[model samples]
Target: MRGLRKVVTVVDEVLRDVGRPVPVPVRRVAVAAVVRNPWAGRGFVTDLQPEVEALAPELARLLTGRLIETLGGVERIEAFGKAAVVGLDGEIEHGGALIHTPYFGNVLRELTEGTSIIVFSDDRLPAGEPLTVPLWHKTAAATRSHYQTVQIRVPDAPRPDELVVIAGAASGPRPHARIGDRRTDPVVRLADLEKLENAR
Candidate 1:
C-alpha cells in the first residue's frame, strides 16, 4: 500500500543575502511556515493527538532547514531562532492546549535554546540584529482578512515590507484549500519529487 502521501508546500519562501549596500550578505536565515494541522484545521481535537504531538518539533526543523538552504546552507546559519504553534486561528482544546503546556515548551526549547538563532513572538518585533524570529498567528489577529502576510525588513530599509505568502489559506473551514497567487509557489507534492529525481 502507498504510504500516506506527503505533500510539502512552500507555503512561503524569502531569500535575502546580507551585505552592506549589497543586501548585507545574509548567508544565515531564519524562517517560519505555519501549517494547517491536517486534523485541526477547524480548531483543536483530541482524537488526532499523536499526529498533532509529532508535528510541532518536526515542522520547526523543516522550517529551519528550508530557510538555511534558501539562504545558502546549514553552515551559513550562524545565527538562528524560531517559533511553533498548532493553529493559526485560536487556542485549541485537546491537541492545541497540549502544545501550550510543557510539551509545546519542549518544542520551543528544542528550536531556540541550542541554536544560533532565537525564536518567539508576542506581538512585538524582535530586539536583535541578524535575528530570524517568527511571529505566530500574525494573520489571525489581523484586522483585515483580505490577505495573509509575513513582514520582513532589512536593517536599513525605511519600512518593513509585508510579503503576502498565501492568500486564502489563512482561516475558515477550508483553510487548507488553495486558489492561486502569481507570487507564491504551490506546495511541493510527492509527484514533483519523483520528477526531480527522474531528471537526475
Candidate 2:
C-alpha cells in the first residue's frame, strides 16, 4: 500500500445471453492497483527478490480484499484469477515478478479458500489500454463452465514508472453454461486417435 498511487474496481453482471433470460445472473469483479515499480529506472538491477518480498504480499492482500468485498462475500466467489501490466519504461518481467510468485498468488488462494493454482496474465503497456484476466474454478482446474475472463482498464495508470496489478473473481460460471466439465470428456489414447484418423 505504501507505493500505491491509485486503485480501481469494476463489477459486471450478466443477466441474459443470446436474447434469453438467465436463471441466475453471473457476476464478475476486477480490482486493479497502480503502484510504483520498484525496479523502474534502476538500470537493470540484478536481484528482484527483496522488492518482491517487501511489496508483493501487501499488494495482493489489498487487491484481493477489495475483490472479496465487491463480490459481496468470499463464499460468493467460485472462480478467480490475477494479472499485471507494467508501464512502458519497465520490463514485462517487472510485472511478472509481482504476480507470478507465491507471495501474491497464495494470498488470493488462502483468502478465497481456493485449492487450484490461480490462472493469470501479464504484460507491459502504456496508460488506458485494456487487459483481460482469465479466471477458472477455484477448486477445480478443469471445470470448463467456470472458465471466463474479466476485462479491466485504468484510465490513467502505469505511467512509464508504475505497474497495474489486477485480481479478478466471479460469483459463478457464464450465464447458462451448458458445456460439461473437462473431467467429463472421454479420454482418447494415441492408438484410438490413429484408428479414428484411419476411419476418416
Candidate 3:
C-alpha cells in the first residue's frame, strides 16, 4: 500500500461588495488540501475520508470569517452558494474516478433557484470526449483529469446539509498556484475569485 503525503491547505471566502446603505452579500467559503499522489511511484491515499471530514469546518470558519468581514461583520449568511475545485495529477484508463456529494443538490436549490454547477478536469479523453460538466443530477458523470483544475459551483440554501466534492483520475504531475497576493489577503477584492471563477 502506498502512503499519502499531505501537501497544502487553502481557505478562501468570496463575496459581493455592493456599495449601498445595506449591501447585499453573496459569499462562498472554500477550503482545500493538496496531498501527494498516493499512487505516485506506486502509492495512493488509502484513507482520505478522515482528512476531508476534518477540513470542512475549518474551511468554513476561514472562508466564513472573510465573507462576514467583507459584509462588515455579518454573523450569518442569508443567501449563499458554494463550490470546490479539485486539482488532480496521474494517469489511468477507463472508469476513472469521480468527486461528488450526497446533498449538494439540496443545498444548491436553497442558495439559487436555478443554480448551475460546473466541473473542470484535464483528462486525456478520446477525440469526442467531453472535458467539462454541469454536475446536475440528470447529467452526473465521472470526470478525469491530471494536474488540471476543475471548478464546480452549486446553488445552495442556508441549510446545514450542503456537501462539496472533488473526484476523478488525473495524469502527470499536479499543477499548483499560490492562493493570492499577501496584500490582497488582508483586504479581498473582486479580482480574486470572481475573475478566476468566471475565466474558467
Error of 3 at 58 (Å): 1.1
lDDT of 3: 0.30
Q: List TM-score per model, in order.
A: 0.36, 0.95, 0.29
Better of 1 and 3 by TM-score: 1
Clash number for each model:
15, 0, 22
lDDT tens per residue, model 1, 159-199: 11111011111111112224544346567899999999999
Q: Candidates ranked by lDDT, best first?
A: 2, 1, 3
lDDT of each: 0.33, 0.93, 0.30
Give the candidate number with the greatest lDDT.
Answer: 2
Per-candidate alpha-carbon RMSD to the true structure: 19.9, 1.4, 17.6
Q: Which runs of model 3 end up more than 4 angstroms from their true locations? A: 1-43, 90-200
After superposing candidate 1 on the true structure, give the runs of residues whose Cα lies further than 4 Å from its correct spot: 1-24, 27-30, 38-52, 84-89, 92-117, 122-200
The deviation in Å at residue 200 for candidate 1 is 71
Point out the higher-scoring one by lDDT: 1 or 3.
Answer: 1
